[model samples]
Target: MAEPQIKDQRGWAPVDTGYLDNPKMLDVLDASGTAALMHLASVLYCAQHLTDGHIAPGIARRKVGGTKDDDRLLIDAGMWHEPGHDCPTCEQPEPNKVYVHDFLQHNRTAAKAKRASERASKAAKERWERQRAEQDTPTDATRMPDALHPAMLGDDSSNAEREKERKREGGGSRRTPSRPLPESWTPSPSHIEKCSKERIDLDHEAEKFRNNALAKDMRYANWDRAFTNWLSRDWVKRTSAGLDPMKDW
Candidate 1:
């Protein structure tokens, strides 16, 4: 397949553009990057699947592998071909430059970006759930594992085993476990204290609402009688009067 010219296309700038400092710009740029990668992926899919045409000169024809390989290429374009050859079309002459840009690179970067996103999201969710659970279940009186605790060392064996299993299954052959966050980069004790104070303030607000007149009236009111009367009389009358019984609350 003819390599698409990397002309002055809009939004093809490198990832570290200054505009990305803004969250909106970051998202827009990332989305554009993803789109470009996807377009590259489609081109690669064609290269590997459709019969190889001349790349303006010398080169072996490309062929797509099995469905699994295809899927891998689709998910992670970086995994597609072993590092070899010059760009097929431009014939850039350098071995690294001779390579085809397709689904593999695009998909690999996309997968990395997506995985990072999911990991951050999972961490945030876990933190939120922990906070909520702690409302009913207090933290252990004993000190929990600090970042440097001995239990952290024990976790290494489990992580190693998982890595081995991943390689065995060929799922994570290229994946490396992420490094721990630096203490300076992570939330500090003072941050934790501030968050705790904020949580206490929120809980106090909820308690105040619970003690408010409206809340007291609603909680102490004849809920059962109201529900029973609605169910036995109002609901029955509504149903008999040709209202949809299923919808009548």
Candidate 2:
């Protein structure tokens, strides 16, 4: 089973206490071996995924800031091992560039620890992105595009309903203007004939009335209404009462 990693948010590292109890630790009393062991142990602890140190000989030696004599002492004390290579002079193992051994026993990063740390970093990054997206979004009341009507997201039926309502209010699309007729107007001979044949006015008087109504200068939706109104008001007043349609032919 994989060991669980510690939940340390402030970034702490792990150190096993078994090294203090090892009998070999007491045997390595020399200055070179002791320093080399400490340096190798620190490198292994910080290497992240490689719980076992697989550092290069030159890099490890340089990072440890130790001498050739110190590196050699580490091998003699069994504190470090070289994989896939041999020492030339002594025919013993020598440190290779690719892999170093015993880092697992001396490091902070186990498989479980690395997994936990990665998970934490990923979760933090996701949260930050979510917040940034939300902050960048606009929340104004009237910033919508012209084409985006309420019917699009709501219901398709509403579009038909709104069109019907518009027609009802406006009496449908107007083929002709509905502007009101003027109170006083002049009537053409054709207009006079259309309204009533009984009432009689001289051609000159009719023309005078037309010119006067034109002077009034009001617009009318139905010219028929204007002509009819003029006949009722002015034509009646001008015509002789004996020529009334009710009593006289």
Candidate 3:
């Protein structure tokens, strides 16, 4: 019947609303001729420690700061049971312990509290395991495609051959293919307006551009851009002196 020791003193213990109005409390109060604070303190100490109502003699004296006379008073008031008393709730009685009378009637036993703590710990562990499993599982979106799986697995020779084939077919190069200027090509309307604004003869410039490209066998990806470049760098305005504009270039 020795009081159990507890490390976790976290939760509240129940106290009846009419505790002070009880006959036993009234008797203890009358007998003590004082507040009877020690009796209430002992009851709380047993509850908080999950001691099953058992109070050690050393705890009553040293921890609770109760005198022998206080213990005697509570015992006389039927609020405490002395050591060596037969307890129906306990399988065997300890010789060096005192118990708060009817303590289990109002509070949880040590075994029950321990079981609840264990169950809570088990549930928390299971929840954490489930969360870990969910995080480790891969989704379909993140899974590698079957077509690219071999490439990812370091099939370097096949990958290199495919890259070379792509280059050979002009599929891998970023540049546009070059071609000779077309015989029927004409200046776009915007370029025609630009030449008119600058007083450059569009027909004359067009004839010279086509002749120059054909003469040199020059090739370009964008013929319009090539024409624009030719206009900017080579075209000359007709002079009033009657000299050929091409001769001024």
Number of the top lDDT candidate: 3
Error of 1 at 174 (Å): 78
Please give the CA lDDT of all the candidate structures. Answer: 0.36, 0.49, 0.67
Superposed by TM-score, candidate 3 places the C-alpha of residue 163 at a distance from the truth, in angstroms, of 22
User: Candidate 3, which ten residues in sequence have the lowest lDDT sum?
Assistant: 144-153
Model 1 residue 237 CA deviation (Å) reads 38
Q: Tens digit of lDDT per residue, candidate 3, span 203-228?
A: 87788778766755666666787677
Inter-residue clash pairs, candidate 2? 52-104
Weakest lDDT window of 10 consecutive positions for candidate 1: 51-60
lDDT of 2 by residue, 1-249 (tens): 232242443444454576554555555544555454554444543464343454444555555566666566655656555554453322223344333334444445547666877898899999999999998876654444222422232334434433443354455764455443345544656765743565455454455445543444334455554444445553244343444432232
lDDT of 1 at 238: 44
Runs of candidate 2 exceeding 4 Å displacement: 1-13, 16-23, 41-51, 84-95, 98-101, 105-118, 140-249
> Candidate 1, residues 152-212: lDDT per residue as tens digits?
3354544553355345434554344433222233233543454364332323322332333
lDDT of the structure predicted as candidate 1: 0.36
List CA RMSD, all candidates. Answer: 30.4, 23.0, 23.5
